[model samples]
Target: MNNAPVRTVSDAKRDFYSHHTRPINSIYRRVVDELMVEMHLLSVNVDFAYDPIYALGIVTTFDRFMVGYEPEADKASIFNALCRSIHSTPEHYRGDAEAIKAAVSGMSLDDLKGQFEHLGEGGEGLRGTLAAIAHREKFKYSRPFGIGLYTLVEAVTPPEALKEKEAVETLFKDLASRLNISPDKLQKDVELYRSNMEKFAQAQEVMKDMLAADRKKREERKKAAEAVAEGITEPVAAAPEAGESADSPD
Candidate 1:
Protein backbone atom coordinates (compact mmCIF):
# COMPACT_ATOMS: atom_id res chain seq x y z
CA MET A 1 0.00 0.00 0.00
CA ASN A 2 1.36 3.39 -1.06
CA ASN A 3 0.62 6.26 1.35
CA ALA A 4 0.52 9.89 0.38
CA PRO A 5 1.46 12.71 2.75
CA VAL A 6 -1.68 14.23 4.26
CA ARG A 7 -0.07 17.67 4.23
CA THR A 8 0.68 17.67 0.49
CA VAL A 9 -0.82 20.81 -1.11
CA SER A 10 -2.99 20.12 -4.14
CA ASP A 11 -4.59 22.58 -6.59
CA ALA A 12 -7.90 20.87 -5.96
CA LYS A 13 -8.83 22.21 -2.56
CA ARG A 14 -12.12 21.34 -0.86
CA ASP A 15 -13.76 24.62 0.00
CA PHE A 16 -16.44 24.01 2.58
CA TYR A 17 -17.79 27.51 2.30
CA SER A 18 -21.48 27.37 1.43
CA HIS A 19 -23.44 30.33 0.08
CA HIS A 20 -25.84 29.86 2.96
CA THR A 21 -24.31 30.44 6.37
CA ARG A 22 -27.42 31.14 8.42
CA PRO A 23 -28.29 32.60 5.05
CA ILE A 24 -29.63 36.09 4.66
CA ASN A 25 -32.90 34.63 3.43
CA SER A 26 -33.14 32.16 6.28
CA ILE A 27 -33.02 35.00 8.75
CA TYR A 28 -35.70 36.85 6.85
CA ARG A 29 -37.83 33.72 6.78
CA ARG A 30 -37.67 33.41 10.54
CA VAL A 31 -38.81 36.97 10.97
CA VAL A 32 -41.65 36.34 8.52
CA ASP A 33 -42.75 33.11 10.15
CA GLU A 34 -42.94 34.66 13.59
CA LEU A 35 -44.88 37.65 12.34
CA MET A 36 -47.33 35.47 10.41
CA VAL A 37 -48.11 33.38 13.46
CA GLU A 38 -48.91 36.49 15.45
CA MET A 39 -51.11 37.81 12.67
CA HIS A 40 -53.01 34.54 12.40
CA LEU A 41 -53.57 34.45 16.14
CA LEU A 42 -55.00 37.94 15.87
CA SER A 43 -57.66 36.60 13.47
CA VAL A 44 -56.01 38.17 10.49
CA ASN A 45 -55.64 36.04 7.38
CA VAL A 46 -51.93 36.10 6.53
CA ASP A 47 -51.62 33.51 3.79
CA PHE A 48 -49.91 35.60 1.15
CA ALA A 49 -46.15 35.66 0.61
CA TYR A 50 -46.47 39.42 0.47
CA ASP A 51 -48.33 39.59 3.77
CA PRO A 52 -45.39 38.39 5.81
CA ILE A 53 -43.04 40.69 3.95
CA TYR A 54 -45.35 43.59 4.60
CA ALA A 55 -45.39 42.67 8.27
CA LEU A 56 -41.60 42.64 8.31
CA GLY A 57 -41.50 46.16 6.91
CA ILE A 58 -43.84 47.43 9.59
CA VAL A 59 -42.02 45.60 12.38
CA THR A 60 -38.66 46.77 11.12
CA THR A 61 -39.88 50.29 10.80
CA PHE A 62 -40.92 50.10 14.42
CA ASP A 63 -37.57 48.66 15.49
CA ARG A 64 -35.56 51.31 13.77
CA PHE A 65 -37.78 54.07 15.00
CA MET A 66 -37.73 52.89 18.60
CA VAL A 67 -34.51 53.82 20.31
CA GLY A 68 -33.76 50.59 22.22
CA TYR A 69 -35.52 47.77 20.42
CA GLU A 70 -32.65 46.21 18.58
CA PRO A 71 -32.72 42.43 18.25
CA GLU A 72 -29.22 41.06 17.94
CA ALA A 73 -26.53 43.39 16.57
CA ASP A 74 -27.19 45.14 13.27
CA LYS A 75 -29.00 42.03 12.20
CA ALA A 76 -32.36 43.76 12.48
CA SER A 77 -31.38 46.23 9.83
CA ILE A 78 -30.10 43.44 7.59
CA PHE A 79 -33.39 41.58 7.79
CA ASN A 80 -35.37 44.75 7.43
CA ALA A 81 -33.87 45.30 4.02
CA LEU A 82 -33.99 41.66 3.04
CA CYS A 83 -37.63 41.28 4.00
CA ARG A 84 -38.61 44.28 1.94
CA SER A 85 -36.76 42.83 -1.02
CA ILE A 86 -38.50 39.52 -0.60
CA HIS A 87 -41.91 41.13 -0.89
CA SER A 88 -41.38 44.12 -3.20
CA THR A 89 -43.96 44.31 -6.00
CA PRO A 90 -42.92 44.29 -9.61
CA GLU A 91 -43.91 47.57 -11.21
CA HIS A 92 -43.71 47.27 -15.01
CA TYR A 93 -41.00 44.76 -15.60
CA ARG A 94 -40.48 42.23 -18.39
CA GLY A 95 -43.16 39.82 -17.20
CA ASP A 96 -46.79 39.81 -18.16
CA ALA A 97 -47.91 43.28 -17.14
CA GLU A 98 -51.56 42.36 -16.84
CA ALA A 99 -50.82 39.37 -14.67
CA ILE A 100 -48.58 41.32 -12.38
CA LYS A 101 -51.18 44.02 -12.05
CA ALA A 102 -53.86 41.48 -11.30
CA ALA A 103 -51.66 39.88 -8.68
CA VAL A 104 -50.81 43.14 -7.02
CA SER A 105 -54.33 44.54 -7.17
CA GLY A 106 -56.01 41.51 -5.64
CA MET A 107 -53.22 39.31 -4.37
CA SER A 108 -53.84 37.32 -1.20
CA LEU A 109 -51.38 35.17 0.75
CA ASP A 110 -52.34 32.18 -1.34
CA ASP A 111 -51.44 33.88 -4.59
CA LEU A 112 -48.06 34.84 -3.29
CA LYS A 113 -47.48 31.31 -2.06
CA GLY A 114 -48.30 30.01 -5.51
CA GLN A 115 -45.85 32.43 -7.08
CA PHE A 116 -43.15 31.53 -4.60
CA GLU A 117 -43.71 27.87 -5.35
CA HIS A 118 -43.54 28.51 -9.04
CA LEU A 119 -40.37 30.54 -8.68
CA GLY A 120 -38.77 27.84 -6.63
CA GLU A 121 -39.43 25.25 -9.32
CA GLY A 122 -38.91 27.46 -12.38
CA GLY A 123 -35.75 29.36 -11.57
CA GLU A 124 -35.07 29.91 -15.26
CA GLY A 125 -37.46 32.83 -15.56
CA LEU A 126 -35.31 35.90 -16.23
CA ARG A 127 -38.04 38.35 -15.32
CA GLY A 128 -38.50 36.84 -11.88
CA THR A 129 -34.77 37.11 -11.17
CA LEU A 130 -34.68 40.70 -12.34
CA ALA A 131 -37.70 41.52 -10.25
CA ALA A 132 -35.99 39.97 -7.24
CA ILE A 133 -32.91 42.13 -7.81
CA ALA A 134 -35.04 45.22 -8.04
CA HIS A 135 -36.90 44.25 -4.92
CA ARG A 136 -33.67 43.99 -2.90
CA GLU A 137 -32.35 47.35 -4.10
CA LYS A 138 -35.61 49.10 -3.41
CA PHE A 139 -35.95 47.57 0.04
CA LYS A 140 -32.45 48.72 1.02
CA TYR A 141 -34.12 51.96 2.06
CA SER A 142 -36.84 52.17 4.71
CA ARG A 143 -39.51 53.59 2.44
CA PRO A 144 -42.26 51.12 1.51
CA PHE A 145 -44.48 51.74 -1.50
CA GLY A 146 -48.16 52.74 -1.72
CA ILE A 147 -50.53 54.36 0.76
CA GLY A 148 -52.36 52.95 3.77
CA LEU A 149 -52.79 49.15 3.83
CA TYR A 150 -51.80 49.07 0.21
CA THR A 151 -48.36 50.10 1.39
CA LEU A 152 -48.03 46.65 2.87
CA VAL A 153 -48.98 45.16 -0.47
CA GLU A 154 -46.31 47.14 -2.26
CA ALA A 155 -43.75 46.10 0.31
CA VAL A 156 -44.08 42.41 -0.54
CA THR A 157 -44.67 42.70 -4.28
CA PRO A 158 -42.34 40.76 -6.52
CA PRO A 159 -40.41 43.41 -8.41
CA GLU A 160 -41.39 43.56 -12.05
CA ALA A 161 -41.08 47.31 -12.66
CA LEU A 162 -39.73 50.21 -10.61
CA LYS A 163 -41.83 53.15 -11.75
CA GLU A 164 -44.63 53.00 -9.17
CA LYS A 165 -42.39 52.07 -6.27
CA GLU A 166 -39.91 54.80 -7.16
CA ALA A 167 -42.67 57.30 -7.36
CA VAL A 168 -44.07 56.24 -4.01
CA GLU A 169 -40.68 56.30 -2.31
CA THR A 170 -39.98 59.73 -3.66
CA LEU A 171 -43.24 61.00 -2.32
CA PHE A 172 -42.85 59.31 1.05
CA LYS A 173 -39.31 60.56 1.49
CA ASP A 174 -40.31 64.05 0.58
CA LEU A 175 -43.16 64.04 3.05
CA ALA A 176 -41.00 62.59 5.79
CA SER A 177 -38.25 65.04 5.07
CA ARG A 178 -40.64 67.95 5.27
CA LEU A 179 -42.23 66.81 8.53
CA ASN A 180 -38.99 65.49 10.09
CA ILE A 181 -41.00 62.50 11.32
CA SER A 182 -39.76 58.95 11.48
CA PRO A 183 -41.76 56.49 9.44
CA ASP A 184 -42.58 54.56 12.58
CA LYS A 185 -45.11 57.20 13.53
CA LEU A 186 -47.11 56.11 10.54
CA GLN A 187 -47.39 52.71 12.13
CA LYS A 188 -49.97 54.00 14.56
CA ASP A 189 -52.13 55.24 11.75
CA VAL A 190 -51.76 52.00 9.88
CA GLU A 191 -52.55 50.03 12.98
CA LEU A 192 -55.80 51.92 13.29
CA TYR A 193 -56.58 50.98 9.73
CA ARG A 194 -55.88 47.36 10.48
CA SER A 195 -58.12 47.51 13.51
CA ASN A 196 -60.90 48.97 11.45
CA MET A 197 -60.53 46.22 8.90
CA GLU A 198 -60.72 43.61 11.62
CA LYS A 199 -63.81 45.22 13.06
CA PHE A 200 -65.42 45.45 9.67
CA ALA A 201 -64.76 41.83 8.87
CA GLN A 202 -66.16 40.72 12.22
CA ALA A 203 -69.13 43.01 11.86
CA GLN A 204 -69.87 41.52 8.48
CA GLU A 205 -69.99 38.02 9.88
CA VAL A 206 -72.10 39.12 12.85
CA MET A 207 -74.53 41.04 10.71
CA LYS A 208 -75.07 38.08 8.42
CA ASP A 209 -76.07 35.76 11.23
CA MET A 210 -77.91 38.44 13.14
CA LEU A 211 -80.03 39.39 10.17
CA ALA A 212 -81.03 35.80 9.53
CA ALA A 213 -82.07 35.29 13.13
CA ASP A 214 -83.90 38.58 13.27
CA ARG A 215 -85.88 37.71 10.17
CA LYS A 216 -86.85 34.34 11.58
CA LYS A 217 -88.07 35.90 14.82
CA ARG A 218 -90.01 38.52 12.92
CA GLU A 219 -91.75 35.87 10.86
CA GLU A 220 -92.70 33.86 13.93
CA ARG A 221 -94.09 36.97 15.65
CA LYS A 222 -96.03 37.94 12.54
CA LYS A 223 -97.60 34.49 12.32
CA ALA A 224 -98.63 34.59 15.99
CA ALA A 225 -100.12 38.06 15.55
CA GLU A 226 -102.05 36.94 12.49
CA ALA A 227 -103.49 33.94 14.34
CA VAL A 228 -104.67 36.20 17.20
CA ALA A 229 -106.25 38.63 14.72
CA GLU A 230 -108.12 35.79 13.02
CA GLY A 231 -109.45 34.50 16.30
CA ILE A 232 -110.73 37.95 17.24
CA THR A 233 -112.50 38.30 13.86
CA GLU A 234 -114.30 34.91 14.00
CA PRO A 235 -117.00 36.31 16.44
CA VAL A 236 -117.07 33.16 18.73
CA ALA A 237 -119.85 31.62 16.56
CA ALA A 238 -122.51 33.60 18.49
CA ALA A 239 -122.36 31.03 21.37
CA PRO A 240 -124.83 28.77 19.55
CA GLU A 241 -127.88 30.89 20.35
CA ALA A 242 -128.16 28.62 23.41
CA GLY A 243 -131.80 28.02 24.24
CA GLU A 244 -132.25 31.69 25.06
CA SER A 245 -135.83 31.73 23.81
CA ALA A 246 -136.77 28.74 26.02
CA ASP A 247 -135.19 30.39 29.15
CA SER A 248 -137.14 33.63 28.48
CA PRO A 249 -140.43 31.64 28.24
CA ASP A 250 -139.76 29.92 31.59
Candidate 2:
Protein backbone atom coordinates (compact mmCIF):
# COMPACT_ATOMS: atom_id res chain seq x y z
CA MET A 1 0.00 0.00 0.00
CA ASN A 2 1.23 3.54 -0.73
CA ASN A 3 1.11 4.62 2.93
CA ALA A 4 3.62 7.44 2.54
CA PRO A 5 3.35 10.43 4.87
CA VAL A 6 0.24 12.58 4.29
CA ARG A 7 0.86 15.67 6.48
CA THR A 8 -1.53 14.98 9.38
CA VAL A 9 -3.64 12.16 10.76
CA SER A 10 -6.60 13.96 9.18
CA ASP A 11 -5.04 13.51 5.78
CA ALA A 12 -4.20 9.93 6.66
CA LYS A 13 -7.82 9.19 7.61
CA ARG A 14 -9.06 10.89 4.44
CA ASP A 15 -6.62 8.90 2.37
CA PHE A 16 -7.96 5.73 3.97
CA TYR A 17 -11.65 6.60 3.60
CA SER A 18 -11.30 7.71 0.01
CA HIS A 19 -9.42 4.56 -0.86
CA HIS A 20 -10.39 1.65 1.42
CA THR A 21 -14.05 1.09 2.62
CA ARG A 22 -15.27 -1.32 -0.01
CA PRO A 23 -17.70 -4.22 -0.28
CA ILE A 24 -16.57 -7.44 1.29
CA ASN A 25 -15.26 -9.98 -1.19
CA SER A 26 -13.97 -13.52 -0.62
CA ILE A 27 -13.88 -15.19 2.80
CA TYR A 28 -10.14 -14.65 3.18
CA ARG A 29 -10.37 -11.01 2.23
CA ARG A 30 -13.26 -10.49 4.57
CA VAL A 31 -11.52 -11.96 7.58
CA VAL A 32 -8.10 -10.43 7.01
CA ASP A 33 -9.34 -7.05 5.87
CA GLU A 34 -11.77 -6.66 8.75
CA LEU A 35 -9.20 -7.65 11.33
CA MET A 36 -6.67 -5.20 9.92
CA VAL A 37 -9.08 -2.29 9.95
CA GLU A 38 -10.09 -2.91 13.55
CA MET A 39 -6.46 -3.10 14.66
CA HIS A 40 -5.60 0.10 12.83
CA LEU A 41 -8.34 2.08 14.49
CA LEU A 42 -7.53 0.79 17.94
CA SER A 43 -3.83 1.45 17.43
CA VAL A 44 -4.39 4.99 16.22
CA ASN A 45 -6.84 5.77 18.98
CA VAL A 46 -4.91 4.12 21.77
CA ASP A 47 -3.61 6.38 24.58
CA PHE A 48 -0.08 6.63 23.23
CA ALA A 49 1.97 7.88 20.34
CA TYR A 50 0.91 5.61 17.52
CA ASP A 51 2.91 4.85 14.43
CA PRO A 52 1.42 7.17 11.80
CA ILE A 53 3.16 5.43 8.91
CA TYR A 54 1.82 1.98 9.64
CA ALA A 55 -1.54 3.52 10.55
CA LEU A 56 -1.74 4.98 7.04
CA GLY A 57 -0.73 1.66 5.56
CA ILE A 58 -3.38 -0.18 7.58
CA VAL A 59 -6.11 2.33 6.71
CA THR A 60 -5.28 1.77 3.07
CA THR A 61 -5.18 -1.94 3.68
CA PHE A 62 -8.54 -2.52 5.36
CA ASP A 63 -10.06 0.58 3.78
CA ARG A 64 -11.39 2.27 6.91
CA PHE A 65 -13.40 -0.52 8.46
CA MET A 66 -15.26 1.57 11.09
CA VAL A 67 -13.26 4.60 12.14
CA GLY A 68 -14.11 7.73 10.14
CA TYR A 69 -14.71 10.49 12.71
CA GLU A 70 -11.95 10.66 15.34
CA PRO A 71 -9.10 12.23 13.39
CA GLU A 72 -9.99 15.79 14.42
CA ALA A 73 -9.95 14.97 18.15
CA ASP A 74 -6.84 14.27 20.23
CA LYS A 75 -5.95 10.64 19.54
CA ALA A 76 -3.90 10.18 22.71
CA SER A 77 -6.69 11.16 25.07
CA ILE A 78 -9.63 9.72 23.17
CA PHE A 79 -9.20 6.07 24.04
CA ASN A 80 -12.07 6.05 26.53
CA ALA A 81 -14.16 8.34 24.39
CA LEU A 82 -13.57 6.25 21.31
CA CYS A 83 -14.51 3.13 23.24
CA ARG A 84 -17.72 4.76 24.43
CA SER A 85 -18.51 5.78 20.89
CA ILE A 86 -17.96 2.25 19.64
CA HIS A 87 -20.23 0.81 22.34
CA SER A 88 -22.90 3.48 21.87
CA THR A 89 -22.72 3.61 18.07
CA PRO A 90 -25.49 1.62 16.46
CA GLU A 91 -24.65 -1.76 15.01
CA HIS A 92 -25.82 -0.68 11.56
CA TYR A 93 -23.51 2.32 11.65
CA ARG A 94 -20.48 0.02 11.72
CA GLY A 95 -19.40 -2.97 9.72
CA ASP A 96 -19.13 -4.99 12.93
CA ALA A 97 -20.22 -3.40 16.18
CA GLU A 98 -19.02 -6.24 18.37
CA ALA A 99 -15.58 -6.22 16.78
CA ILE A 100 -15.27 -2.47 17.18
CA LYS A 101 -16.48 -2.59 20.76
CA ALA A 102 -14.04 -5.31 21.76
CA ALA A 103 -11.04 -3.87 19.94
CA VAL A 104 -11.60 -0.36 21.14
CA SER A 105 -13.06 -0.70 24.61
CA GLY A 106 -11.29 -3.85 25.79
CA MET A 107 -7.76 -3.06 24.69
CA SER A 108 -4.89 -1.20 26.38
CA LEU A 109 -1.09 -1.50 26.26
CA ASP A 110 -0.86 -2.58 29.89
CA ASP A 111 -3.72 -5.06 29.62
CA LEU A 112 -2.46 -6.40 26.34
CA LYS A 113 1.07 -6.77 27.65
CA GLY A 114 -0.13 -8.42 30.83
CA GLN A 115 -2.34 -10.83 28.95
CA PHE A 116 0.54 -11.73 26.66
CA GLU A 117 2.87 -12.36 29.59
CA HIS A 118 0.25 -14.50 31.35
CA LEU A 119 -0.19 -16.71 28.30
CA GLY A 120 3.50 -17.61 28.34
CA GLU A 121 3.48 -18.26 32.08
CA GLY A 122 0.84 -20.90 31.61
CA GLY A 123 0.76 -22.35 28.13
CA GLU A 124 0.35 -20.52 24.84
CA GLY A 125 -2.42 -20.89 22.33
CA LEU A 126 -3.66 -18.87 19.36
CA ARG A 127 -4.56 -16.07 21.77
CA GLY A 128 -0.95 -15.78 22.84
CA THR A 129 0.27 -15.48 19.28
CA LEU A 130 -2.28 -12.86 18.35
CA ALA A 131 -1.65 -10.77 21.47
CA ALA A 132 2.08 -10.72 20.73
CA ILE A 133 1.61 -9.53 17.17
CA ALA A 134 -0.95 -6.86 18.08
CA HIS A 135 1.15 -5.41 20.89
CA ARG A 136 4.36 -5.29 18.86
CA GLU A 137 2.67 -3.82 15.83
CA LYS A 138 0.75 -1.09 17.65
CA PHE A 139 3.49 -0.01 20.05
CA LYS A 140 6.09 2.18 18.32
CA TYR A 141 9.81 1.57 18.76
CA SER A 142 12.23 4.49 19.06
CA ARG A 143 15.23 4.94 16.81
CA PRO A 144 18.71 6.17 17.74
CA PHE A 145 19.50 9.87 17.70
CA GLY A 146 22.32 9.48 15.13
CA ILE A 147 25.10 10.27 17.58
CA GLY A 148 27.41 7.37 16.66
CA LEU A 149 26.67 5.98 20.08
CA TYR A 150 25.15 2.52 19.64
CA THR A 151 24.87 1.82 23.37
CA LEU A 152 23.08 5.08 24.06
CA VAL A 153 20.83 5.10 21.01
CA GLU A 154 17.60 3.20 20.34
CA ALA A 155 18.33 2.89 16.62
CA VAL A 156 15.79 3.18 13.76
CA THR A 157 12.31 2.31 15.00
CA PRO A 158 9.09 0.24 15.08
CA PRO A 159 10.06 -1.42 11.81
CA GLU A 160 13.53 -2.10 13.14
CA ALA A 161 12.28 -2.72 16.70
CA LEU A 162 11.49 -6.18 15.48
CA LYS A 163 12.11 -7.96 12.21
CA GLU A 164 9.04 -6.15 10.88
CA LYS A 165 5.40 -5.52 11.65
CA GLU A 166 3.81 -8.76 10.55
CA ALA A 167 0.35 -7.67 11.74
CA VAL A 168 -0.34 -5.79 8.51
CA GLU A 169 1.55 -8.04 6.16
CA THR A 170 2.16 -11.72 6.89
CA LEU A 171 0.72 -12.20 10.39
CA PHE A 172 -2.61 -13.41 9.10
CA LYS A 173 -0.81 -15.67 6.70
CA ASP A 174 1.11 -17.17 9.59
CA LEU A 175 -2.06 -17.56 11.64
CA ALA A 176 -3.94 -19.07 8.73
CA SER A 177 -1.28 -21.71 8.41
CA ARG A 178 -1.67 -22.71 12.04
CA LEU A 179 -5.37 -22.32 12.86
CA ASN A 180 -8.74 -22.85 11.27
CA ILE A 181 -9.66 -19.17 11.49
CA SER A 182 -12.36 -18.47 8.95
CA PRO A 183 -11.31 -16.04 6.28
CA ASP A 184 -14.86 -14.66 6.35
CA LYS A 185 -15.39 -14.52 10.11
CA LEU A 186 -13.94 -11.76 12.31
CA GLN A 187 -11.05 -12.75 14.60
CA LYS A 188 -10.53 -12.03 18.27
CA ASP A 189 -6.80 -11.38 17.97
CA VAL A 190 -7.13 -8.03 19.67
CA GLU A 191 -9.10 -9.71 22.42
CA LEU A 192 -6.37 -12.28 22.71
CA TYR A 193 -3.78 -9.54 23.17
CA ARG A 194 -6.04 -7.91 25.71
CA SER A 195 -6.09 -11.23 27.55
CA ASN A 196 -2.47 -12.36 27.14
CA MET A 197 0.93 -11.10 25.87
CA GLU A 198 3.70 -13.52 26.92
CA LYS A 199 3.93 -15.79 23.92
CA PHE A 200 3.96 -12.83 21.61
CA ALA A 201 6.48 -11.04 23.81
CA GLN A 202 8.81 -14.01 23.70
CA ALA A 203 8.31 -14.38 19.98
CA GLN A 204 8.90 -10.67 19.39
CA GLU A 205 11.99 -10.62 21.58
CA VAL A 206 13.46 -13.65 19.86
CA MET A 207 12.99 -12.03 16.50
CA LYS A 208 14.21 -8.67 17.80
CA ASP A 209 17.43 -10.13 19.19
CA MET A 210 18.08 -12.18 16.09
CA LEU A 211 17.49 -9.17 13.87
CA ALA A 212 19.57 -6.90 16.10
CA ALA A 213 22.49 -9.31 16.00
CA ASP A 214 22.24 -9.47 12.24
CA ARG A 215 22.19 -5.68 12.03
CA LYS A 216 25.21 -5.40 14.31
CA LYS A 217 27.15 -7.85 12.14
CA ARG A 218 26.22 -5.97 9.02
CA GLU A 219 27.39 -2.71 10.58
CA GLU A 220 30.64 -4.31 11.61
CA ARG A 221 31.26 -5.61 8.12
CA LYS A 222 30.46 -2.26 6.60
CA LYS A 223 32.86 -0.52 8.97
CA ALA A 224 35.56 -3.09 8.24
CA ALA A 225 35.14 -2.53 4.52
CA GLU A 226 35.38 1.25 4.94
CA ALA A 227 38.50 0.89 7.10
CA VAL A 228 40.17 -1.27 4.44
CA ALA A 229 39.35 1.26 1.76
CA GLU A 230 40.72 4.09 3.89
CA GLY A 231 43.95 2.21 4.63
CA ILE A 232 44.60 1.65 0.94
CA THR A 233 44.05 5.33 0.05
CA GLU A 234 45.89 6.79 3.08
CA PRO A 235 49.66 7.45 2.67
CA VAL A 236 51.85 5.13 4.81
CA ALA A 237 54.14 6.73 7.41
CA ALA A 238 57.75 7.36 6.14
CA ALA A 239 60.16 4.51 6.92
CA PRO A 240 62.72 5.22 9.67
CA GLU A 241 66.47 5.47 8.70
CA ALA A 242 68.48 2.21 8.68
CA GLY A 243 70.38 3.31 11.84
CA GLU A 244 67.19 4.33 13.61
CA SER A 245 65.67 1.54 15.64
CA ALA A 246 61.95 1.57 14.65
CA ASP A 247 61.25 -0.71 17.61
CA SER A 248 63.26 0.59 20.58
CA PRO A 249 62.12 -2.00 23.10
CA ASP A 250 64.98 -1.00 25.41
Top lDDT model: 1
State each model's CA lDDT, in order: 0.38, 0.35
Model 2 lowest lDDT segment of ten: 144-153
lDDT of 2 by residue, 100-127 (tens): 2233244443343343343333434324
lDDT of 2: 0.35
Alpha-carbon TM-score of each model against the true structure: 0.25, 0.23
- Model 1 is weakest, by summed lDDT over 10 consecutive residues, at 8-17
**lDDT, model 2, position 75:** 26
Shift in Å, residue 145, candidate 1: 11
Candidate 1, position 197, lDDT: 48
lDDT tens readout by residue for model 1, 216-236: 999998887888788844534
Name the top TM-score candidate: 1
Q: Backbone clash tally for model 2? A: 15
> Which portions of model 1 miss their true places by more than 4 Å?
1-182, 225-250
